[model samples]
Target: MKIELAENYGFCFGVKRAIKIAEDNQNAATYGPLIHNSKEIARLEKDFKVGLTDDYKIFKAGDKAIVRTHGIQKQELQELKDKGVNVVDATCPYVTKPQEIAQEMSEKGYSVVIFGDDEHPEIKGVKSYATHGALVVTSPEELEGVKLHEKIALIAQTTRKVEDYMKVANYLIPRYKEVRVFNTICNATFENQDAVRKLSKKADIMLIIGGKNSSNTKQLFKISQENCQNSYHIEDEKDLDFSWFDNKNLCGISAGASTPDWIIQNVIDNIKSKIS
Candidate 1:
């Protein structure tokens, strides 16, 4: 069997930069997991003694605190600073754009609509910036009965699928008088998803490597599964079942933006070993 990797997979600029920020600030404590990968968090904890905590109340003065790439609520960050915690912001620039847009739109008297999961950390952070608070919608149907202002602003979580966001925008544009759409999806996310869509045509089986909780990884897995029924989302080699690859002549590999090259390599090596 031939093994091929996706055109764009593994760590993106934001994730690589976030990991570097954690490494540079040894003995620091991130406000949350710096990124979504558990193995990478464990590596940081073991190698640099960087701890992870989601609560701002527990952090003390003179201690270092790194903001997650998904960012945090504005009030929570302010509270951390007020407590004299040395803050090292590792928020991805892509995630910050939507927050700024949400705040500005709300300030201008426009009702804001975010196309993403309400419970996601990024969405929570972005919603806090909206002056009038924003409506979170995962689909166009979610917007059906919600009352809206004449002027409306639309944005999406950095990792959500482009098509899904567009679906909501398409539904709103016709109904709303003035609609402003910001393509807030990260460039890396677009590339990864596009690459998976391309890989779906050539491979018999697909392995998507990333943490189960990773949104971007889940998107890739979903995109792949839609086109190829033999797709599997696995965190690492341990999750791989040999039977999935049985009689498969070609296998494709893809990883989320948060996934490190080492994990991808290990999974690739393991898959190749089983092939023979």
Candidate 2:
């Protein structure tokens, strides 16, 4: 069997930027996982001595704290700064756009509507920027029967599928007098999703790589599964099941924005060895 990789898989600009920031601040602790990939985080900890802290209060005055790429709630960030922690913002520019939009739109008297999982860190951070509170929904169905203001402003999680975001926009545009829709989804997401959609159609087996908790990775897995029944989402080579490769003619591989090339290569190498 032959192995192939998606054209636009692994380590997006934001993840790369965050990694560099973490490397530069060796002794600093990130408030959350710097990125979704645990292996990469481990690599950072082992090599650079960067640490991860779930609680912001652990940092003392003058201690360095690197913000996660997903960002923290606006209040949390302010509190960190107020506590005199040397804060380094590593929030992805793409994620920051929605947070700014939510605040700006909300201040302008537009009801903010975020198309994303409310529980997601990015969404929680973005939603906090809305002065009057924002509505979070995963689908158009969730918006049903909910009362929205006459003027609405909509933004999406950076990693969410555009088609899903559109469904939410379409639902509001018809009902509201003025609906302002911002394309907060990043360019990397567009390219990655398109690449997976194309590759999965041709490969007999598909491996989507990234952290299990990664939203973008989950989206890639969903798209791959839609076209290839043999699609599997794996974090690394260890998760591979050789049984899935039986009689497979060609294996396609794709990784999420948060995934690093090293992990992807390891999975590929393992697959090649097993099938050989």
Candidate 3:
């Protein structure tokens, strides 16, 4: 059996930036999980003393509050600032682009349409920026029969697949007079997806590693599964099932943007030990 790793996998620029920010601001609390990987968050907490807080109100006036990479709702951010908390923005630049686009386009009287899961923290924050409210949908069918303005501004969650986002855009372009589509997908996501897709096709077994709640990780798994039926999404080495690799000639491994190299290496090491 052979083990192969995807060309582009593990911590992306944004996740690396957020990790650095968290390290620099020891004793500060992030409003949400700094990134999707719990193990990395635990590592930061243990080493840097950085804390996680679900409620923004818990911070005192002098306390430092680091914004999560996914960002927070506009009103929640404003409220935190109004309380005089020392705010440190660690929001990914790619995520911020959609938020700005939503706010600017909505103010210009364009109906905002976001292609993403409405319940996702990134989408929730981006949607909150739309002055007149934004419609969130997963597929082109969701836009069916929905009455939108003549002019529409479409944005997507940074981690969503470009193909899916295009389906939403294609649906609107034919119906509306003017539809402005913004490519908000992160470059790292594009690379990781493509790499996994390619690797999965050649491997007998594929492992997509990252947080279970990570949207991007799930996307990678989805793509891997499409190409290779024997695909599993695992957080770390602990989640590995050795039986899956039985008689498998090639094992492909890809990690999400938020996943750390340490975890990926651990998975590789464990697999090597078990199969050697």
**Where's the lowest-lDDT run of ten residues in candidate 1?**
267-276
- The models' CA-based lDDT, in order, is 0.92, 0.93, 0.94
- Pick the lDDT winner: 3
Cα-based lDDT at residue 96, candidate 1: 85
lDDT of 2 at 258: 89
Model 1 clashes, total count: 0
lDDT of candidate 1 over 36-142, digit per residue (tens): 99999999999999999878788899999999999999989889899899999999999888989999999999999999999999999999999899999999998
Model 2 clash pairs? none
Listed in order, each prediction's TM-score against the native is: 0.98, 0.98, 0.98
Off by over 4 Å in 1: none
Expressed as tens digits, the lDDT of each residue in 1-276 for candidate 3 is 699999999889998999999999999899989999899999999999998988888998989999999989999999889999999999998888999999999999999999999999999999999999999999999888899999999998999999989999999998999999998988999999999999999999999999999999999999999999999999999999999998899999999999999999999999999896
